[model samples]
Target chain A: MPKVLMKGNEAIGEAAIRAGCLNYFAYPITPQSEVAEYLVRRMPEVGGVFLQGESEVAVGYMLFGAAGAGARVFTTSSSPGISLMSEAISYIAGAQCPAVFVNIVRGGPGLGGILPSQGDYFQATKGIGHGDCRMLVMAPASVQEAVEMVMKAFPLAEKYRNPVMVLGDGLIGQMMEPVEFPDHLKSEPTNKDAWSTNGMDHRNSKKRNIVKSLFLDPALLNDNNLQLKAKYDQMRSDEVMFEAYNTDSEYKGLVVSFGTMSRVCRTAIDLMKADGIEIAMIRPKTLFPFPEKAVADASKKPTCTHIISVEMNMGQMVEDVDLSVKGHLPVSWYGKCGGEIPTPEEIIDVVKSRIA
Target chain B: MQSEVMFAGFGGQGILVMGKILAHAAMEEKYEVAWVPSYGPEMRGGTAYCTVVIADHPIGSPIIKNPKHLVAMNGPSLEKFAPTVKKGGVIFINRSLISFGANRDDVDELAVKIMEIAKDLGSVKAANIVALSAFVARSGIVSMEALKHCIKEEFSNKPKLIPLNMEAVVAGEKAGKK
Candidate 1:
């Protein structure tokens, strides 16, 4: 694998092409429009289908249409645009369709600022649409990770017969970094023959495959919910990932963060390490599964004195961190709303002041 | 272990191109690098800033609030970023666009007329590339050979424009020599 300098948005598009995603449908939005633009030019050259729908609403439906037919389908959008696609997202999850959605997050309550923000932590993890369905949400911190996650998302979505959401903010979407594309990926194309709505023929005449979430029977819905829960449980056991640094020192405190915030925390750690005020971070890569056990163990350790959750929003992911640590250690929150990314020095100041 | 620098200025000032040159040089030195720009609506006729990180070790954070080095292309950028430069850090300013020099005594300042130098060389469009050349020469931030290699690589895809940009680089370096 050879590393190439690529922007986060362009990396997502390139990785999807290399990952064998032949179908992509999206509408242009801020901080994420590059992903669509890159695909529009590259998709055709790779024998892939790229369509710009009438709007995000229509694009989500197109994703559903293609994904229901078992094609590797995806779409990219930001905060407000993601809001429009939420309804269709629910439908895709309900039908157990394998679709990959990328959210290059921007700040917002409604049509908010275009700066990077992580305020959608809850909207991404807590089942945005409705019903008893969930998405496998992966948070990428860098352009390289963003590319790799986009590639892995297709198979993960198919393995569970669910939607995989690659959630990032404007920073990750806009930044450029060097990344290596794998030469050989374990080929796992969509099971078109077994599940897709392509056609029915002499292959199997006993029964037809209809993909939908609608269940008329109440008992059947209950069973479906249980099965989904089981899938989620397995994900909890298998998919949690985090990076910890300088935790073994005479660390007085811990900084719990994710996505871009984690990178800031790492910088703060580098600055504060010399002062003997050691700080460590637990960055949750998968927000849906929430890396509970890893966080719980870190927070419960006797050497770890206190825990603080830092983010770009006003305490969305902090709540999840709070839930994980619980009463084992005192959990605090710090952040800047409306896409203000806190600096390392500011974060270190807050940690030093709070923990001491 | 890692160093991050942000260069910010208005569009057409060559802020992004400067950052790209530094990134290219860093990669040539066998170091980790990333160049991220403010694009789309924020890029058209608006202020543009880019974060460029170069490190012997893997860079953990790409965003730099208090950059180790600051290169300001205009007055607003200097006013906005003067206080954020790390203590004892160096700041290079384009005196042609910015009237006020670095007032703080904590950091070293080099105020050069980058646009004037580019215009004197018959191309005002090369102002940003000139500023980059100045930074490499005066600040010695990246080596001259490294900057030249980066310039060669950047224009490799667009071979026709190679001569003009390379000329801009030499003009910038010559202006910063004093």
Candidate 2:
């Protein structure tokens, strides 16, 4: 398909349809409500189902129910909406169901504002809901990338039988850009009949598929936790993705950033290059199963002196950057979390200060 | 290598649509483009604005603090955004709605009475097209041919309105050259 100019939110809905995902359950939220708006009309045309629950909490369980029945299901929400859905996220993860969640993050501890933010870094990567729940998180910097990530998320979710997250900021939801839907469609159902509760007659086996998160026995629960932990470990080795910019030259510092913040830093790096002062940036495409080795290796180079994590939130990703660097370099954070994005000039100034 | 245009006006004034048209033009020309709107808390008569960035390479940042151009369709828009426009860029002001200048000498100001011009052509709704076409003619960021084509394609569904919009585009282009 030729590239057509489209808003990020609307394109995401189309991408899901193209990816053969027919079930979309979500509640309306700023910066991302367009997804629901687009899908409500779109789903019917494609013979798919689009449902808006009374609230996000109800919507989350709707996802659990659909995903348990082995239908490609997903939801889109903002910060607080995602918070409301966290319990269902944990339950879905524990039940080992494949589902996709797109969080177009807005600023918040509470109903803060409807603006682009990376505040949910910790929530998405560390603690989404509770108890050994770690979603395989992919962060896209552009609308095209957002579409691509959402398409790739479903297969990855099924690969490990876990929830995969496509984490974007408000800008990725609100902005318009040129996007082309991928030609290939994997409408073929995955090999999930053995686990999915689609009834005994549907699958080859006589054993009924029981989809539940509750493993009441201590040993059984331990086994389930270990199984989830093993999937995470495998992701660490297999699915780490990142982009390294201007890393070839002897740059003074390494910038660790993701999503829209990284795009701003990319501009800053280009400007700094023209000034004869080179700076490198490592943008992690996958937040979890993070590009730890890439960051550590890029920063450990003899020429790279200081490393800084630039973000829209108050130093959330910096912690992960620090953990990745492992004290090899003096790690610091520069941010403006009050819904105001740091410009290229501001990022350039911060990098200068870090090097100085 | 890159140019950023800011379109600001009242909410009902089609500011976002103006920016989208410019973005589509740029994309048709094969330049990477991004259109970001002010999706903040604003009402119908309240403030509305959008920024369009066109770059030869991939657009690095969509959050443009200082735009290369400003097309202000109202008084408050010019006053709020005029100061932030970079020097040596075009600033289009709707003189019919705004009386004051941009208060700067470094930028090029094309103060046109878009509403009056659109009204003279036929309807007042074409004010945004007048302003947009005029600004594109002045800036030359995208070719005039490309801009016109995109405008036609944008109004493709409304076959009846295409001719009027095209007329508005030509009128604005003529006004922009002056």
Candidate 3:
């Protein structure tokens, strides 16, 4: 496909249609409302279902219902809206249903601001829902990457029978860039007949497929949790995706960042390279599978001294970095919680002062 | 290899659209581009601005503090962003609305009466197109042919507005040469 200038949110909406995900349910919120706005207009043209739920909570259950029936379904919401959808997300995960959620994150524990932020890092990767639920979280630094990740998410969700999240900041949702939606990435729902609650007649006379998260007996609940844990373990084993930048040769500092913040760090790395300062960076494309081994291996560089986690939030991802570094290198966190993104100069200064 | 332009004006003045047109033109020239807008609540009824980053390489940080050029549609926009333009870069001032100078001697400042030019051309709504053409023509960031194609494509839906906008581009490019 030819490249077109598109906002990240609108590109995401178009990407789902290209990916053959015909079910979309969403609630309007700042920064991300454009995703719903775009899909509401485009879905009908493609003979797809576009329903704007009353709230994010309703949207979450709507995704669960559509996805349970083996339909490719997704929704888009911001931080606070995601919070309302958390319960249903947990239920969807518990039932092992396939769904996609795009969180174009805004600021705060409450409705702190409508600008971009990575404060929802923990919310997306760790606490998307209650219980032993985990979503395969993908963080995209650019609009093009968001389109690719959104297209890749449906197949990944079906592969694990789990929810997959394309986590982006408000900037990723609001900014416009040239993006090409590859024709090859179109995907159809696969292998859903065995477990989906699609009508038995549709599946060629199979036993009833009950899609529910509730396991009344304690042993069954434990078994279900163990089954979910196994899927997550498999994700860690086979689904880890990451990108390493400027890691060749020896470097004094290693920076671990994801999402929009990674692009800023990338610029800082380029500026520092020009100044005869060597710094390597690892940007996690999949925040869930987390790319722990890549961070661990990159930290083991002989010339590396310390690591810094630069994010838009206070210190959420730093804890994970510290764990990934395994205390071999001291991991420090620097960030701004407000809507203001950390500048490239700020990142360079922090790495120079803190790494040494 | 990389340059940024800031388009600043009040909310209904097509500030974002101006940046988008520049970005589209740059993209047509096979350069990577990103268009970032000030999406704060202030866009409701306050100063609206957008930054267009055009680079030969993939853009890293979309947020730009100091842009390479400026298209100030009003006095407040010029007062706010004119100082942020890099030295030796083109700064397009819509002199029809902004009365003051850019106060910088280091840059090539092109002051055009964009509003009056557009008004005389048939509609003041084409003022953004006038300013965009002036900025593109003076800065040489993208070729005039590429920009004209983008302008034609932008108004492909309403073919009626294409001729007036094409005239505005001609006038702005003429003004930019001065």
Candidate 4:
């Protein structure tokens, strides 16, 4: 493996390119703009289309156009821009289109701030748009993980016939680390023509394919919702992913965090452990199918009495932690909104206080 | 405990590179490390600072509002970050540019005329490396082997510049002998 220093945003772009995504559509936003800038030059080199869409709205539609034609497509944006694309995201899910979306999140209630934050956790996991739809949300804590997830997302999205999002924060988007491109990774063009709306040649004209979500009948809509719900149920079993550290030992409480926040939590746990505090962390890699079992299991022990959720948001994921623990254990939250990241010492202090 | 350092100067002054080299060294020394560069408009002809965190274990938060070690290559950087240095922590300043010395009594200040030494050695670009070398030698925060290990790793890709930077490191180490 050849190691090259790369920014998280640029790694996402390179991974998409390697994953055979020939088309990219996005609008500029803080932190994530580097991925777009990287693709601007890189996509052309690889015989791909890189479009700086007129707006996030146009970019979403363009992604729909590309995915409809059976092309591997990708687009990335931050919080507010993602809000604009939520409508198209719903449409893609309704159409059962396979594509990748990267949300390098920033703080936001409404144009909240430019700093990195997990405020969009609920939006990404709960299906931000109207209507019945679900997306595969992968949270990457480092640039290396970001690259690997983007590569893995293609197959995962195709398998589920849904959009897979690599959700992260601005800091993770901008931070630099050595990344190694997977050896022997090759991009094989996927022929999704069976489901795509691209016009078939005369030789294949006898068979027609149309991609639409217009179920005029109410019963059909209900049936579609049921089918979507079933897919989500299956995903809960198939997609939940997490990492446990120092969990084998007797621990006091479990720390729940994701993305860049998890990296910080790991450091905090190490520090507290060295200082004689026996804390552990359950880092969720899949934000949607949130390894709820792991969290619940951690709460089963009487000594592990607290579940602390740390994030860049005010408190988006704490709700999920609460739901997972089901009031069996008290769930607490310590976080900063906007772009501010909580240091390990601060988190250690918070965890110690909670344990006490 | 987490150790934070800020290396700041104008763009093209090698401030960021030096910070990265130090971070890489810490990592090689088996310490957890994080290197965050200044982004946005501040990087264009203005003061640029990169924060580096090195810890015995994993690092948390990566954002240090009060860095323990400061390598201010210019006046503004020293002025901006001086007061935040922890008491007894070292502040290594480039005496050629930052004439206004640090005022904090709690922090230990090392005034190195790194630019003058680099000029004697033939270029201003070496000043950042020299200051880093001086800090490493005097502060003993990182071992010489670790610094050399980091230098080798950082220069492994840019093979052409290794000799000059190594010489600068030598010059810095020699100069820091107090």
Candidate 5:
């Protein structure tokens, strides 16, 4: 198929449709509103359901209801909006529902600027909701990667019977790039009959399928918590994804980044390489099941002396890098918040200052 | 090879669309391309700009600090971006709006009366197309033919505008080639 130019937001919406997710519930938010807008027009054309809920809170539950009923459902929002959806997200995770959520993050502590920022990294990968619930968060670095991740999110969500998040900063949501949806990523909708809320008559079974997160009994709730923990452990071992660049040779410093910030690191690496400075990068594709081992191994390399985590936020992902490095090498941090993206030259300067 | 171009002007001057068309044409030519616009508050009654990166290989970053080519459609845009063009880069100015020339001596600067040409061609709305044609002709970033095809496709829904846009392209190309 010929590639077409598409913004990251619209491409994700189309990719979800191609992935066979017919139900979409969302509220309009900057940088990500295009996803909802695109779906509003395209979903009905494909005989799917598209609804604009009153708020992010409503959309979260709408997704919960639709997913509980065994439909492939998804929603998109920005930083503040995601905060509004947190309680419902916690419930969905506690209930072990299969749904996809996309966060085209914007800057924030509270009502942050509308520009792109990875400030939601901590919110997303850590403490997204209350209780012991974890989401399989995938961060895409490019528009094409965003498309592929969105298409893969559905199956991944169902496979774990858990929520999956496609995390992208505002740049990924707003930029236009040429993309082609790969046919291999397309899959038939998963069989939801096993756990869906379809009537007993629809399933033709004697047992009832009940979907709820309320477990009042202490022992029973503990059991549910243990089950969720086990799933997260399995994901930690099996679902970790990352990409390493220029790590083969000796390096004076290693940079850890994710999403759009990784591309800036790539350019910085190239510039430093041209000046005879050896620098490598590790980009984590999955933020939750972070590429801890990769970062640890890269940090242990004989020539690697220091590590730095560059992000769009003040220092969210550096904590993860610090955990991965674990005293083998020092992990430094550099970032600009409030939607200000650091340029390649700026990153190069940071590397110089750190490694010098 | 890679060409990093920035198009800048007032909000309603179609600066973003110019970059989009260039990006679309680059995609048509099978080049890896990215178009990033200055969105949000700056887009409402303020300066509007977008960067288009066209490269044979994948683009590393869409946000460029020093573009190799700049299409400045107004005085403020020209004043702000002319110094940021890479050394030995090209700056295409809309002579109809911007009175001053580029201050840098190392770069190649070309000035075209884009708005005047578009006005004479019967639609001042086509000024962006004129400036885009001038940039492509001057920089040879994308072929004139590919650009024309992209313009026609961009206005495919409103077919009547294609002829006027094409005329603007030819007139601007003539001035740019000179």
Candidate 6:
């Protein structure tokens, strides 16, 4: 297949469609509005449903309702918008509904700024909402990876019957890159009839599956939480994905980053390597299922003395890096927030300061 | 090999489109490319800029600190980005708007009267195309033929502007050759 030049947001929208997701509900937000804009014309052309809800809050429930009804549905939003949807996301996760949410993250403590940021790292991988629920989060670094991750998201959501989040920063959302949507990644969604409220007649059974997060009995609620925990454990063992750059060789320090920030680290690693300062990188492709072992192993390298987390925000992912290193190595952080991206030279300086 | 180019000008000057076209042309030529725009409130009337990175291998960072080339369409853009161009790199300045030029002695500088050339071609808005043509012609980062094809495709919806854009490209190319 020939590659086509596409923006990351539009590529994700197209990838969702190719992945056989026919329903999309979203509210317009900068750095990610392009996804809704692209899908508006595209969904109808494919005999799908596209809707711009009254607000991000409304769209979250709409996606929940759609996904609960056994339709492959998705939505895209930025930081503040994602915050609005966290309630619904929690509901969907608790109910064990399959949905895909793409958070083209921007700087935010609260409406911080609409630039590339990883500030949502803790929110995404740790607590998106008030629950014991965990989401399958995939962080893609490039437009092509964004496309692949979106395509993979649908099946992954259905596989675990859990909501999957494709997390990227504004750079990945806005930048244009060459991409080819591989045919192999396109697949029919798995059967949701057993658990979905697809109408009694659609399932050819009189029994109706009720989708709700409310468990009145304490025992039943505890059982549900235990089951969710088991599923999460299964995911941790099965779905941890990451990319290693120059990890095969011995290094003085290890850099951990994801999404667009990882690309900056790659350039820094290259520059430092040229200057005879060896550094390796581990870019976690999946933010949740956090690639803990991969990071731990890399940090355990005999020559590796420091683990640095480079992000677009102040020290979010560094906590995870700290956990992965487990005090065997010191974890440091370098970041620029409120829409400022750290330059490769700046990152190199940080690495040097830490390891020196 | 990689070539990183930064295009900067006033918001309405089509600086982003120039970067987009170059990025599209590079993609057409089977190169890995990334185009990142400086997007925000400043984009309303403030100086706008975008970076286009074209590489034989995958691009590491889309946010380039020191670009290999620069297309500065106005005085502020030139004043701001000229020094950031790497040594031995090129700076293509739109002399029609800027009185000052790049002070760098190490890098090659081409100051083309792009707006004046586009005005002669009867389309002032085509000035970006003019500057883009000169940059491509001088740097050879992308073939002129590929750029022409990209321009046609980009303006395919507004077919009426195609001829004027092509004329602007030719005029700029001639100016660049001189």
Residue-wise lDDT of candidate 6 within A93-188, one digit each (tens)? 999999999999988898888888889999999998887998999999999999999998999999888999999999999999999997854444
Global Cα lDDT for candidate 4: 0.83
Interface RMSD in Å per candidate, to 1 decimal?
Answer: 1.9, 0.5, 0.5, 2.9, 0.8, 0.8
lDDT of 6 by residue, B124-161 (tens): 89989989999999888999999999999999999999
Q: How far is candidate 5 from the true structure (C-alpha RMSD, Å)?
A: 1.3
- Off by more than 4 A, model 5: A184-188
The TM-score of candidate 3's chain A against the true chain A comes to: 0.98
Alpha carbon deviation, residue A299, candidate 5 (Å): 1.1
lDDT (Cα, tens digit) per residue for candidate 2, span A1-356: 78899999999999989888999999999989999999999999989999999999999999999888888999999999999999999999999999999999999889989989999999999999889899999999999999999999988998899999999999999999999899756764576785689887777777778899999999999999999999999999999999999999899999999999999999999999999999999999999988999999998889888999999999998988899899978999999875799999998998998898
RMSD for each of the candidates: 2.3, 1.1, 1.1, 3.5, 1.3, 1.4
True contacts kept of each: 0.59, 0.89, 0.70, 0.39, 0.70, 0.73
lDDT of 1 by residue, A172-216 (tens): 988877788865344445355555676675234344778878888
Which of 3 and 4 is the better model by lDDT?
3
In angstroms, give how far residue B154 of model 5 lies from its true place. Answer: 0.4
Q: Candidate 5 chain A, which ten residues in sequence have the lowest lDDT sum?
A: A184-193
**Candidate 3 per-residue lDDT over residues A25-60, each given as its tens digit:** 988999899988898889999899899899888999
Highest-scoring model, DockQ: 2
Residue-level lDDT tens digits of model 4 in A1-356: 65666778998999898887878999999868998889999999999999899999999989888887778889999999999999998988887778789998888888877778898898998966778787889998887889999998887877776788989888788777667777434453254655677776622445676677778899988887787788889899998989887788689988999988888888778778888788888889998888889988887866787889998888888888899999978899999877778888789889888888
Per-residue error at A107 for model 6, in Å?
A: 0.8
Candidate DockQ values, in order, are: 0.60, 0.91, 0.86, 0.40, 0.82, 0.82
lDDT of each: 0.83, 0.93, 0.91, 0.83, 0.90, 0.90
Question: Candidate 3 or 5, higher TM-score?
Answer: 3
User: In candidate 5, what are the lDDT values of residues A1-356, reduced to their tens digit?
Assistant: 89999999999999999988889999998989999889999999989889999999999999899888888899999999999998888888888889999999998988888899999998899888999999999999999999999988999999888899999999999999999997744344456766689787776457677899999999999999999999999999999999999999799899999999999889889878989999999999999999999999999988877899999998989999999988878889998988788899999988988877
lDDT of 3 at A22: 87
Residues B1-178 of candidate 4 have per-residue lDDT tens digits of 5788888888878888888888777766667677888774463688788898888764556767788999988888888889888888889989988778899888878888998888788777778888999999978878988887778777788887778778888999987767
